[model samples]
Target: MSRFTTQLAAGLLLAPALLAASAVQAHETGDIIVRAGVVAVDPQENSGNVYVGGANTGLEVGVDSNTQLGITGTFMLTDHLGVGVLGATPFKHDIQLKGVGRFASIKHLPPTVTLQYYPMDKSSVLQPFVGAGLNYTTFFSEDLSSAAEGLGFSDLSLDDSWGYALEAGLDYKLTEQVYLNATVWYADIETTATFRTASVPSKVDVEINPMIYMASVGYKF
Candidate 1:
C-alpha cells in the first residue's frame, strides 16, 4: 500500500485507543470548528483520446496526484448537524500523455461546501460524520513543457468544473477544545482541455474523479 494509505490506516487503528481516555463534550449548537493539515488529491482519470483538428491521436491523458495545505471550517447548527467548508492551497498536477513524458502542468483550487451529519452524541470522544456537498474547481496557470512547445503546442487551458462531492470523517477529542481529525472525500470532476498544436485547435475531454484525504488538527470555539 502507499505511504499515505498506511498512515491513514494507522490513524484509524489508533482512534479507538485514544477514545478510551476521558471524554469531553463534543460539538454543540453555535460552536465553530476550524482545522488545518496536509491534504492529498488522487485522481482516477478517464481520458478521451486527444483530438487534433478533429483527428484522434490515440494519446491518453493522465494526471499525477498532489499534496497541499488544507483548511476547513464548520459551524454547528445543532448538536448533530453542521455546515462545513473545505479549502486548500492550489494543487499542481503533472499532465502526462501516453508514450510521452510530462507534457504540461496545471494548477487548480477546489472549494467545497457540505451539510454534515454527526452520528455520535455530544459526550462521545469519537465523533464520526458523513457529508454530501458541491465542489467548484477553478483551473489556472496552465503551462506547456518545453518539449511540447518544441512540438508546436501552445495556448493550453482547462475549463472550470462544478461537481458533487461526498465526505466521511472522524474526530477524536483530545481535550474540550482540541481534536485530531481525518477525513476523506470523493469528488466528481470533469473538464475539457483545449490547446493549439501546429496552429490547429485540439481538445480532449478528461474525467478526473478524485479522492481527497486530509489529516488535521482541529480547534473548537
Candidate 2:
C-alpha cells in the first residue's frame, strides 16, 4: 500500500512535464524522456483453483490464453533509467474444462510502475533493459453457469489483486524514435472469488504466476 502512494506521486509530477515537452520542440531533452509503445502480450495459459457456490474438490476451472492488446509508456528520469506505466483493455481470457467445456471470459486490469535500466545506446541496434515493478490486477464482470441455479453464487465477490514483477526485454532500434521492443515479465497475482454454484458458498483462491511476453513498436520524445 505504501508503494502505491510513491508511484502515485511520481506519476502526478511526471505526466505534465512530459506532455509539455512535445510542444516546445527546442529544449535540451532530459535523458529522462517519455516513450509510448504498442504492446501485444501473449495468451495466458492457467490451471488451478475452481470455485462453485460451495467447496467441491471434484470440480475445476481451466483458463485459456488470449492475445493481449495494450500500451506501455516510460519516462526516463536519468541517463540509463526510467519509470513506466501500462494501460490496456480489460484482458478477456477464456475458462475451459475438459468435461464441462469452456466458460465465459474473465477480465483483468493490470497497471504497473517500474524502474527501468537500459544497457546500450539508441544507435547501437540492440539494446536490452531490465526492471523491477509492482503490478495491480483487478477483476470484474464475473459469470456463472445456468445449471448452477439455487447455488450460493449470489454471495460471491472477487477481491482486488496484485503482484510483484521482475522483467527483462530487448529493443531493436530501427530509427531515432522508432524501435521494436520485446519484453517478458513474471507476475505473482493472487486472485480469488466466491463460488455460489455449490450447496454452500465456498471461497476458491488461485495463485497465478503468469509469464507475460510482449512485443511492440515505440516512439520516444
Candidate 3:
C-alpha cells in the first residue's frame, strides 16, 4: 500500500504541468498508436451497512490503491476519430475494515473500450481528446487474512461488475511518430461480496468507483 501511494504521488506531481507542453506533430488517419506506462487504480469505496443475526450492524470498508504496468492501443478511423482499448497487469487491492483492520484482499482486471475524439487536426502538435466507453471488471483470487480466518471467515468471493467509463487525455508530439501521453479515467463499479463464518453466511454490497491515471510514451505506426 505504501508503494502504491508513493507511485501515485509521484505521478500526481509530474503529469498535470506537462499537459500544457507544446506539440511538434500529430497522428494521421489509418495510424495505430500504442503506449506503455505505469498506471494507478485508486478506489473510492462505499460499503453497505452489514447485517448479521438479522440485526443491523455498522461496518466501514476501504480499499487501498495499486500501481501496475499499463498499456493502450488506439486505431484511428479518421483524422479526428479513433477507437481505443485500455489494459493493464492485474491490480490487487487491500481491503481494510474500519476499527477491525485489514481483513481481506482481492485482485481484478478492468478492460475498457472507448471512442475517442481529437480536437486538433493532424498538422497540429498538441492533441487533446475526450472519450466515453464501457468497462467490465472481473474479480478473482479473493482471500481472507489470518485474523479473518481465525474469526471463521472463509470462502470469500466478490461478484463481477460492468459499468461506464469516461476519459480525457493529452498528447504532446515529440516527433512525427512518437509522443508523450497523459490520461485520466473514471469508472462506476459496484459488487456484492459473500463469505462464510462459523455460524452462517454473510453478505455486503461494495461500490468501488475508481479513478485511474496513466502517463506513457506512445509510438504511431
Give the number of the best model, judged by lDDT. Answer: 1
lDDT of each: 0.95, 0.63, 0.88
Candidate 1: clashing pairs of residues: none
Candidate 1 residues lying further than 4 Å off, grouped into runs, are: 1-23
> Model 1: per-residue lDDT, tens digit, 1-98?
99999999999999987875545578989999999999999999999999999999999899999999999999999999999999999999999977
The most accurate candidate by TM-score is: 1
Clashes of each: 0, 9, 0
Q: State residue 209's C-alpha deviation in candidate 3, in Å.
A: 0.7
Candidate 2 structure lDDT: 0.63
Ranked by lDDT from best down, the candidates are 1, 3, 2
Taking every candidate in turn, the Cα RMSD to the unseen true structure, in Å, is 12.6, 14.7, 14.8
Give the lDDT of residue 135 in candidate 3: 96
Over 4 Å off, model 2 = 1-56, 97-99, 121-123, 147-156
Which ten residues in a row are the worst by lDDT in model 1?
Answer: 17-26
36-116: candidate 3 lDDT, tens digit per residue: 999999998888865554555587678899999999999999989999899999999998877788889999999999999
Estimate the overall C-alpha local distance difference test score of candidate 3: 0.88
